[model samples]
Target: MILSVALSASLALTGSPAHAATKPVTFQGFTIQVPIQWHAKKEGVNLRVITGVCSPQAAECQSFLLGGPQAVKYASEGGPYRPDQPYHPSSGVTECVPVKKYNSGQATRVRTSKAVFGAGQRARFTEWKVSCDGSELNVASYTQRVWYVKAKKVIVVDHWKTPGLGGILAKAVWS
Candidate 1:
């Protein structure tokens, strides 16, 4: 229920760096084929995937999140909260916790990288999650920010605070 703003690098689909093989994780009627090495932790309806990144800023940690409510939020873009924006607790969201919001104009970024995917269930609540590197979370990037939706929402988790990683999270989809 913690709504925080986040982003990574922009996806250069034309010729981006491909990682390991794809192993798709199916949950809640959707399949997520993330890099084969990522490990998954199933907690009730949410299947959390832990991905590895080789970087000096942070290593042996940081991952890409797949499946669960958040993924549905981005794929459909019809949820209740937008990326990085100040959170307004919605009735559909029963678990959201209040968190400090950054005032650096998240609305503009939401408009730019906004995307909607998946057909999740009739959302009973909107859940906000921020990607964490180790124990810290809410690292900011230029092209990422808050976005708003009409109904309940979900999210995909990502590490790093640059716009580059954000691109991969947005484009990645499960078959």
Candidate 2:
């Protein structure tokens, strides 16, 4: 019985993660609806799904961050920061995930995000980036995200920033 119980516990952890929460919380000015797993902190939140992690697949993470809420440069020597030339460290990134680019045109729609159609209001796969004052990005960021409504809930999930995978928290969704 003990062995069986241990196996079950392991399955719960290793098995497929539970779908995210589907509630919208209004902070500052913007309204964001996300899953429960994507817990909201004082700043932003964190969620995970079939996206990139800190282990690998970080190359694709760059294309997601269009910019930041602030008027700062991204891949250059300036305000927030710039990519390290050699042996880049992953300590800078604070929060990294996809965001909802509501006003994005069709041109960026194809590359910036992914759509998940559903019965009711479809959850838009948006990129979520960290910011200083809902303007300038602080650290790392995510490339993209998958947003969808499951069981009448809007949830957003993606890869957790890890080593090698790097941090990507720029051009986030905000008010």
lDDT of 1 by residue, 1-175 (tens): 1232222233333223465356766654445456656677774454556665444443223444433455443342344344344232222322111121322222232233334443332222122332322234454322223322224334443432323334334443433
Tens digit of lDDT per residue, candidate 2, span 78-107?
Answer: 332222121111334333233333111111
How many residue pairs clash per model? 26, 23
Off by over 4 Å in 1: 1-19, 53-61, 66-112, 116-153, 161-175
Give stretches of model 2 more than 4 Å off: 1-21, 43-175
**Top candidate when judged by TM-score against the true structure:** 1
Can you give the lDDT of residue 84 in candidate 2? 18
**Model 1 per-residue lDDT at 166:** 41
The C-alpha TM-scores of every prediction are 0.38, 0.24
